[model samples]
Target: MDLSAVTAALELKSYNKVADILDNLMLQVAADGVAFHNDWPYAIHLLSHFYVHDINSARFLWKTIPSSIKESKPEITAVWKIGQQLWLRNYGGVHEAIRGYEWSQELQGFISAFSELYTKEVFQLLVSAYSTISIEDAALFLGMSKDDATSYVLQQCWTVDSSSGMLTVKKQPVVTEQKLDPRKLQQLTEYVFHLEH
Candidate 1:
C-alpha cells in the first residue's frame, strides 16, 4: 500500500478515504508487524481515528505501537496522553496536558478539527453533572462566551432561560425498543468478527 498517498489524502482532509486505507493498513500491520524504520504511518493512523472519534481503535493502535517508537517520539506520548484524558472524560486534564505543549503542524491541525467535538463532549459532561447550570458557568468551562454557550445549549434542544442565565436539559426521549436495520446488524456482526480474529 502507498503510505505516502494516505498521508497526502490526510493532508487534503480526505478523512473517509484515509480511514478506509488505514483500516486495510492496520490489518496488514497486524499480520506482518510494523516496518520499524519509520513511525509516521502509526501517527497518521492514530490521528485519523481521533478525527473520526474512534477512540477504541485509536487506543488499540496506541497499545500496539512499539515502546521504542513511542520513546523516540515525545509527540506520540503527548498525543496519547491527550487521548487518555479524553477517554477518561477528563476534559480539564486534556486542556491542562495540551496547554503549553508545542504541537507539530499536523497535530495542531488535528486538534483544531477535534475542538468542535471536544466542545460538545464537554457540554454533555456538564449536562450530566448538573440538573441546571448557569450559562456563565458553562461558558467558563467551555472557554466560550456566554452568548455562545447559550446558543450551544439551545442548539442541543436544551431549555435556556436567558433572563436567569440558566440552562436545563430536557428529559431524553426513551427508546422502547431499538429495531436495528439488517445492514446495521450485518455491520455489527462484521465488527464482532474482526474483534475475534
Candidate 2:
C-alpha cells in the first residue's frame, strides 16, 4: 500500500476513505503475519482514527505500535499520549500534555480538531463538577462569553436563574427499592437470569 497516499488522504481530512484504506492495509499485514515495518503509516492511521473520533480503534493501533518507534518519534508519542488522555476523558491531562510543545502544521490541524471535541467534553465535565455556577465563571472557565455560557446551560436542559445569574442543574433522583415483596424480587431475579441466558 502507498503510505503517502494514506497521508495525503488524511491531510485532505477524508476520514472514511482513510479508514477503508487502513482496514485493507491491516488485513494484508495480518495475512503476512509480520509486524508493521514502518511507523508513518501506523501513525497516520491512528491520527485518522482520531479525526473520525474512533477512540477504540485509535487505542488498539496505539498498543500495536512498536515501542522503538514510539521512543524515536516524540511527536507521534505526544499525539498518542494526548489521544489516550482524551479517550479517558482526562481533558486536563490532554491540555497539560500539549501545553508547551511546538506544534507542526499537521499537528496544529489535529489540535484544532481536538479543541472542538474538547469544548463539548469540557461542558459535560463542568456540568458534573458544579450543580450551579455563575455564567461569568462558566464562560471564563470555558473561554466563552457569558451569553454563550448561559445558552449552553439552557441547551443542556438546566435552569438558569436570571436574577442570580447562576445555572442550576437539577439532579435526577435515584430510585431504589427500599422494600420489595419476596415474590416480586424472585420474579425479577428469574427475569434477569433468563435474559442473561
Candidate 3:
C-alpha cells in the first residue's frame, strides 16, 4: 500500500481523516487479496480510531489485531492501553496512558488530537451533567493542573467560589430548531386535501 497519502495526512495533522483513509486502504488491500498486517501501521490505525472518539471501532480493531503483532509491537499494546482506559471511562487513566508513553513522531499528532477531543467531550459532559464541580475533579477530567483547570473554566464564564473550591459551569443554551421542509409539508398538505375531498 502506498502510504504517501497517509504520510501527508499525518504531516497535516488531519488525525480524524487518517482512520477513514486507512479503512479504505485496508478494504482495497483485502479486495486484492494482499496480506497487509506486516506492512500496516496498526498502532496509528488504532490511535486514529480513538482520535475520532470511535471507541467501539477501536475495540473491534484491537480484538482483530494478531496476537503475535500485539506481542512484538509494544507501541500497539501501549496504544490499546489508552483504548482500554477510554472504554472503561477511566478519565485519569486516559491521561496517564497518553502521557506515560513515548509515542513516535508519526503517531504523536494522533495522540495530541485524541487528547484534545477527549478533553472537549469531557467538558461537554460536565456542562450538561453538573451545575457545580470540585476543582480537583475538573482537573482530572480535563487532564490539567488544578490551577489550569480553574483558569480554563473561568475563561468559559464558569464561576469559581473561592471558599467552596468548586466551579459553577456555564451551560450554553441548546437551541434545537425543528425545520420542516416546506416542499414536503406542502406535498403532504396536498395529499391530505386530495384524500379528504
Candidate 4:
C-alpha cells in the first residue's frame, strides 16, 4: 500500500488521521499477504496510537511486531516503554520515559503531541476528581515543574494556596446546548465499535 496518505496526514499535523490511515494500510497489506515488518515505520504508527490514548491498540501493535525488528530497533523499544508506562497509569513514569528517550526527527512531533494530549487529559481528570491538589502532584501529572504547573493551573482560573502549596481546581461550567458535529459523532461511533471487537 502507498504510504503517501499517511505522509500527507503527518505533513498536515493530523495525528488522529495518521492512525486511521495506517490502520487502513495495515488492513490492505494483510489482505495482499505482504510483509509489513520492514516497509513501514512501526514506531511512528505505534506513537500515533498513543497520540489518541489508545493504549490497547498500541499494545496489540507492539505484540504483533516481529521479535527481530523489536530487538534491532531501539526506537521501537523506547516507544513501547512509554506505552507500558501509559498502560500502568504511572504518570510520573510516563513523563520520565518521554524525557529519557532521544526520539528521532520522524517521531519527535508525535511524542510532543502525545505529551500535551496526556497533560490535558490529566487536567480534565483532576478537575473532575479533585477539588484540591498539591502543586508537586499536579506538576508530576502535567509533566511540568512546580512553577510551570502552578502557572498553568492559575491560567485555568484555579486558585493556589501558597502556604499549603495546593491548587484549588476551578471546574468550568458545562455547556449543555452545544451541538455535536455529526461527522465527529460518526467517527466516534466507528472508533468505539472497533474497540469493542
How does model 1 score by TM-score?
A: 0.62
Q: Residue 97: error of model 1 in Å?
A: 3.2
Worst 10 residues of 4 by lDDT: 35-44
Q: On a 0 to 1 TM-score scale, where does candidate 4 land against the true structure? A: 0.85
For 1-197, candidate 2 gives per-residue lDDT tens digits of: 44675777658866557766886778886798766656345555666676667888888878877888888777777777767776776655666665646666766765666556667767777867888988887776555668987887788788889999988875545688798699999999999999999
Model 2, residue 105: C-alpha shift (Å) = 3.0
Candidate 4 residue-pair clash tally? 0
Q: Taking the tens digit of each residue's C-alpha lDDT, what string does model 1 give over 2-104?
A: 5776877758877646656878876786578666436456666676676677889889889888888898987878777777877886766666656546878
Off by over 4 Å in 4: 177-197
Clash-forming residue pairs, model 3? none
Q: Report lDDT (Cα) of residue 192, candidate 3.
A: 100
Off by over 4 Å in 2: 29-36, 124-131, 134-197
- Deviation from native of the Cα of residue 51 in model 4, angstroms: 1.9
| Residue-level error in angstroms, candidate 4, position 49 | 1.4
Task: For candidate 1, give the lDDT.
Answer: 0.73
Clash statistics: count for each candidate: 0, 0, 0, 0
Alpha-carbon error at 96 in model 2, in Å?
Answer: 2.7
- Models, CA RMSD each: 11.9, 9.0, 5.5, 11.9
Reference-based lDDT, residue 102, model 1:
85
User: Ten residues in a row with the worst lDDT in model 3?
Assistant: 105-114
